[model samples]
Target: MKVFDIIIQAMLSLRSNLLRSWLTTMGVAVGVFSIIAVMTALQAIDRSVAAGLSSLGANTFEIQKYPAAFFGGHGRNRFINRPDITYEEGLAFKRLMQEEARNIGLKVSRSGNQATYRNRSTNPDVVMVGADENFTAANGFDIQQGRNLVEQDILYARNVILIGHEVYTTLFPQRSDPTEQLLRINDDVYRIIGILARKGAAFGQSQDNLVVIPITRYRAHIDSRQSVGITVEASSRSTYSSTLDQAVGAMRTARGLTIRQENDFELRTNESLVESFRDFRQTISIGAFIISFMALVTAGVGIMNIMLVSVTERTREIGIRKSIGAPGATILQQFLLEALFLSLTGGAIGIMAGTGAGNLIAIAFNLPPILPWLWIGIAIAVCSAIGISFGIFPAYKAASLDPVDALRAR
Candidate 1:
């Protein structure tokens, strides 16, 4: 009659039908895994996006030739055909927004560059950026040593450069001073004017594997035809909106767009980027939840079917117990406990497996290990509910059985 004794009985019953119990438990495990793995991966992506978005400074936005991202390929070709944001237009826009904005930077970038210092060379994956003096403030980069590029560097299109931390380490592994060191990229030899502070990886890509050169030099000696990206920073957060409007108007004027004509350039910012990611996360979450719900419903049905069979098989046992004065509530409690044990056991296995699987994605994204605690807690609660909801009917059926008829049955 003790609760512990009833608990022991419930566990014993499950042990006696180990194969059936395990099969039912697996159903529950699958359901939990479906949701947990998805959520874990999504959370990892969110973390990476949050970190990567910091690459753009506060109250800063970018104006480029195309949208930051395009999905489903619906209108991808339209963006491709849009005219490049010419270097001249970028300069004109900068001049127009100069008074309204705190700083305006014109930049262009090309990837797959190699930098050489003495005999040491960086991997060909290095990015070469053409930037103005305001690049560090407009972007979220800081010079750790030496000095930023001056107005004369851009004015005369000098062969001066700022090396990123990765380049610094790769080329100067001996801890030798990098300031004023001569380096070569392409056929152009340049002197390093500054050393950059390390900006850690974002979404598995190193942020410190590039070098910055004056936009003038980049256009003259580097890739002249490449589209330029303009970065504009607002003086204050309160003025960010007005600053963006002013920048947009300036860009429109620079591009010679009429009143009926649409602006040809794209506006990209950390806020817009985060909002896009949030929408993506929401869509994926909904899909995962639906799949998990279906799996859980199937698992619940499996639990109910197995419990019904258990009741039928134990009809004589139930009659004997009732004849000996065991209460219906006690029988119900034992059955419910058995179901709960099965569901919870499965959920534990699923949680561990899902976390491991999802973290594989996080590792690939270069993100740290993450535990989706909220999803885990929800899984536990859901398992408990499934067990009780599915097990109660069978328990009631067993408890209400007539002693005479149950004893007569085989």
Candidate 2:
């Protein structure tokens, strides 16, 4: 038989048992959905992490009391008991690295606070950060209106704040310029000295739901026990490693660490952050792949059972065709095509549904939509392979049946 005729015959056979065919296809659909949905979501997350980390600008690193992330295992106690990087130590390190660094920024942050302007108030999801003049340049935040906090503001502990785009829009819904206005944080009323240009989102959270105050004021008015985090900008990319070394040595000296004592603080850069995320993403991807593989294997078994039943029911038809000069190869081809069609149909539907679901999640998290075409293509290929692998035995049985016996029995 011609290829097209075989395909048409295969499709007709499936259509004749529409309900059974659909149920069988559903198994494959679910399997494909599991693989595609998670892979799509992970692709979007990878894209978001890359974009977010790059937003911190180039040739920069931070020193803090704890690592940016911790993978649970041994040595948790050491990090837990490490001393906080004090404000005094931060300044002394700043003074020590003045000539070696291009720009040094100090910041401390507290989250889950409300900011009120007049009768309008933001949800308690607002984040309050204390920073100096270098914060804008070091962190790559641009002032949309008014000016960033100057050194004098931090030195004198001014009661002024810079609002992020989300905070500004939420508090001043009318789009009015918020500069020179007063906003209340706790019992303290602060002047809105500037509005930050929209910086978008990072890792599913808004980067713009924050308020910035001077570091000195943050120490004076807010919790003083929290460690200060310091950002150090290398003079150039080539010197970044050297600058990090200088920062480590300077921080050790400022904190009075001996040569034998291991450094208590953690230092991280954009490169390290990206590497950490890559490892995290890989671990999650492997887990998802394993789960999806199991589902697909289950679906393959279902396809095999359904195809075997199809062969049994069509034995007389196969006998009649073989009796009329039909080749065993043609019989095998017909059954194989039927199975392939079922799997591909399910796979096509699953791809559409999975992509839509993944994109919906991405939208909810405010991440850019990412279509993993490579994965989609691979899914379809896998579906085809599964169909051929599961259908071959049944197709071979149908093709090898004795024509007289099959005809006589049925």
Candidate 3:
């Protein structure tokens, strides 16, 4: 028989058993849906994270007490055992690296603050970040209005502050502009010297809902303990490697680390952050693939069982075809094609459903929608392989049946 004729016959066979075909297809659909949805969500998250990291500046590096991403489980003493990077230590490093580095920014953050403007109070979940004047330069932040923090502001620990776009909108909605609005942080009032340009969202969280103050004021007023992170920017790309070395060395010296002892602090650059995120994405992809494989395995078994039943029910038809000079290869090809069509149809539907659902969820969270085309292609190929491999035994069984015996059995 011609290939097209065989294909038509296979499709007709599947159409005749609509219920069984649908059930088999449902299994493949479920398997495809599981992985496709997960992959879509993961890709969306990765894109958002990458955008956020880029917003932190390409040549910037940060010194912190903890790593950017930690995967291993921590013991009970993890918290208490970790050493704190003190303000004095940060200052020492800043002084030591001043000659080599272009800019250094000290940062600290406080949460759960209520800002009030004569009764119009903001939500308590607002974040207040204390940073140095160099924060704008090192962190890729642009002022929308008024002016950014200056050297004198950091030196004298000024109460003046810069507000993010969200804060400005919420606190000064009535006014045409928020550059002149005075916001109250806790009990103290601060003039809004500048409004930050909108930086969009990251990891499903808004980046425009923060208030910026001088790090010196933050240390003295909010938290007197230690600095949380220090950002460093190199003057030239040529000095990037040496600058990192100098920064690490300076930090080690400040922390009083001996030759035998390892440095306690973590240093993260933009490239390192991207690498960490890529590693995380890869791990998630592997996990998703394993889960989807298990589901597909079950679906494959279901297909095999259904195909076996189909062969047994069509024994008389098989015998009739063989009696009419139909070859075993033709019978095998027809059955295999039927199985392939069922799986491919199911896979196509699942891809559409998964992508739609994933995009809806991303849209709800205000993130850009992502469709993993590479993964979708892989899913289609996997489904086709599953159908062919699982349907082989039953197709072979049908092809091997004796015409007279099959006719007699029916």
Candidate 4:
């Protein structure tokens, strides 16, 4: 018999036990589904976060009291013990980098404040930030209406504020421009001088839900104990690296950190943040791979068991084929093909289902759809190998049956 004939016969044998074949295929399908679903969601989330992080601008870095992110207990304890970055220290650093850096901004933030304009009041989810004149340009925010904060606003601690896109929409739901309007923040009142353009969410947190006021005003009115963060912008793309180095030195000196003592402040740049996210992405990818691997192995085992049963039940038929002068190799090929057909069918079904399910989750999170073609190809190849590996023993057993003994047996 030709190879094609063997495959056809094998398929026919599988058709004789349709339910069992489908069950075996489903096992492999589930394995493919798990990894594909996870990968699709992860890819979408990564894209969304990358776009948000890019909005922080490539020429800027921030100096804060603690690291941008923390790991385990040791990491948390280390940052917790560090002193707060005070507003005075931020000013001193700014002065030291006067000639080297293009712009330096000092800022402090407090969250959970209700903004009220007459009887309309927002939820206590608003973030109120105290920022210097340079904050808007340094942080890559554009003034949509009216003007940005000026030096006089920060120096005199003026009662002026810049409302974010979300704040404007919430306070003035009619979509009217809110410039010059008096916004009541808690017990204090500030005139809105500008509105910020809409900035979407970053890491699942809305960037447009906060309000910005002069840092000097925030220190006097809000809590003075909170640390102030300093944002430094490089003079040019060529000077960015040297500028960062200078800022680091200036900050350490301003904070009075001796050479022997490690610097207590944290410096975060766009590249560093991207590198951190890359590491996190790798960890997630490894976990997904391991989980899928285990599932695929279990499915492969199912294929082996089912194929073994098939060989045993067809012993008499096998003997008759052997008696009719069919080659042992042909018998082996038929059994192996049957197992391969089961695995590949399951894999195809799994790929479709997994891709659809994964993309749906991405849509829910407002992320673009991601199709994992590479993983799909890998899955199909893996399924083929699994089918061959599991089918080998059963194929060899059927091929080795003695014709005389097999014919007399059942």
State every prediction's TM-score relative to the real structure. 0.89, 0.94, 0.87, 0.85
Q: Pick the TM-score winner.
A: 2
Candidate 1 C-alpha lDDT tens digits along 344-398: 9889988999999899988887777799999999999999999999988988888
Q: Which has the greatest lDDT? A: 1
Cα miss at 107, model 2 (Å)? 0.7
Question: Scored by CA lDDT, what does every candidate get?
Answer: 0.89, 0.88, 0.84, 0.87
Candidate 4, lDDT over the whole model: 0.87
Clashing pairs in 3: none
Q: Which stretch of 10 consecutive residues in model 3 shows the poorest summed lDDT?
A: 71-80
- Model 2: CA > 4 A from native: 71-74
lDDT of 4 at 127: 94
- Scored against the true structure, residue 106 in model 4 reaches a CA lDDT of 87
What is the model-wide C-alpha lDDT for candidate 3?
A: 0.84
Worst 10 residues of 2 by lDDT: 49-58
**Tens-place lDDT digits, model 4, residues 122-170:** 8898999999989888888888888999999989999999999988888
lDDT (tens digit, per residue) of candidate 3 on 1-410: 99999999999999999998998898888889878987888778788877877776666789987777666566425634678888778888889999998888888888888777666877997889998888877777789888999999999998889988888778777746666567799977887789888888876677788899998898888887855689999888788889999898999999999999887888887677778888888987788788778888888898889889999999999999999999999999998888788888878878988888777777777679988999899999999999998989988998899999988766
Which candidate, 1 or 3, has the higher lDDT? 1
Candidate achieving higher lDDT, 3 or 4: 4
Tell me the deviation in Å of residue 310 in model 3.
0.7
